[model samples]
Target: MIDVEETYIENRVMVQPNHANNLQTAHGGHVLKWMDEVGAMSAMRFAGNSCVTARINQVDFERPIQVGDTSLIKSYVYRAGRTSVRVRLQVYRENLRNGKQQKATESYFVYVAIDDDREPTTVPELGVSSDRGERLRDEALAGEGQ
Candidate 1:
């Protein structure tokens, strides 16, 4: 069993000119790519095996990550099946100078563990050993307007 906290991952990327759209905001595709990478890393940590994205829930871009700003992506595995893991992911727009952050996008991602043969492999059960882990699991469960 792997503690949810142990699977948690956070990454940051500075939005560059090439990452922006005509409006000078970070492109949706770039944000998504970052999310996918972070989510995969979290799932791999939880499963102890290579993982592949199987599904992504609705992603809403609430705010924009402008050029010269940083994007902080946070992800953690919340639940797991025999071979699949569910991750809660959130992206925030960050201002390095002011240390201010505003949530930009949030979503759920499902990943399947794979073996060396590139076949779906069983994953260890997700463990919630601490109060923080339990709280994060609850938060992910209640995200769908529950």
Candidate 2:
């Protein structure tokens, strides 16, 4: 069994002019790309193999992240099947100076482990070893969109 915490991944990206849209806010495409990358990393960590994005279960942009702000992304594998791993991803717009943050986006992604031939491969089971990890898993499963 793969521990939930072991599959966790966190990344930070400082929004720049190139990443912004016409409104000077971070482009939705860039944000989604970041989420996908982090989610894939988490899934691969849990599967112990290369994993590819099989599905974007859902993505909700709660707030816009402006240019010059930092985007903090956190991802973790909360569930796993024989060949698939489900990851929960969250992005926050953080104020570097004051250390305040707001939820900018949240989503769930599914990834499939792939073998050398690029065919689907079995992935290890996931198990939560801590109360916090269990709570996180349950909360992710019982979300607004599941």
Candidate 3:
């Protein structure tokens, strides 16, 4: 079984000039990029092998994060198959100036572990071991309309 603790991952990035569009707000593409990166990290952590995106179900941008804000991406593997890991990611924006924070975007991504030859590889089964993990898994599954 997959180590539940190992399946959770987080990454943080600052919204720099390059990550913004002409509007000064965090660009949708950049947010999606970070979500994909963090989701992949969670998948790889759960699979213990390299993984590639099989699908990005959807990305919902709820709020705008301007420059100077820090984007924190949290991801966890909530389900797994023989070769696929389903990851849920949440992106939040921390505004240092006002000490405010909000969820900027969220997405669910599916990844398939691959071997060196680029063939699908098996991954360990996921285990829900803690209240937080179980809760997150429940949330993700519910978000998937399960």
Candidate 4:
């Protein structure tokens, strides 16, 4: 089994002009790409094998991340099936200058583990022994489908 906390992954990207749209805010696609990458990392950590995105739940952009800001992406594997890992992904906009941050986007991604032959493989069960892990898992479960 893999602890939920052990599957956690965080990444930060500096929003640049190239990442921004005409309005000078980070494009939704870029944000989603970052989320997917981080979510995959978390899934791989838990599955101990390569993973492929099988589905992405609703993604709502709560706020726009302006250029020159930092995009903080966090992900964790909250649930694991026999051959799949479910990850919760969230993105935040941070103003490094002032050290302020706000939620920018959130979503859930499901990934299926694959073996070297590119065939679906089994994944270990998710473990939530610590209070922190349980709380995180509960939060993710409650927020699912919302």
Q: For residues 42-139, what per-residue lDDT tens digits would candidate 2 score against the true structure? A: 99889989999988866778899999999999999998998999999999999898999999989888999999999999998799999989988998
Tens digits of per-residue lDDT, candidate 4, 1-146, equal 78999998889999999999999999999998999999999999999999999999999899999999999998999999989999999899999999999999899999999999999999998888899899889989999879
lDDT, candidate 1, residue 110? 96
lDDT digits (tens) for residues 1-146 of candidate 3: 77566778887888999999899988998888888888888898888899999999867788888898999898999889899999988889987777677998887889999999999999988998778878888898999752
Q: lDDT of each structure?
A: 0.95, 0.91, 0.87, 0.95
RMSD per prediction, one decimal? 1.0, 1.0, 1.4, 0.6
Q: Give each model a TM-score.
A: 0.98, 0.97, 0.94, 0.98
Q: lDDT: which is higher, 1 or 3? A: 1
Error of 3 at 21 (Å): 0.7
Error of 2 at 53 (Å): 0.6
Candidate 2 residue runs with Cα over 4 Å from true position? 144-146
Maximum-lDDT candidate = 1
Is candidate 1 or 4 superior in lDDT? Answer: 1
Cα error of candidate 2 at position 101, Å = 0.8
Residue 50, candidate 3: Cα error in Å is 0.3
Q: Which regions of candidate 4 deviate over 4 angstroms?
A: none
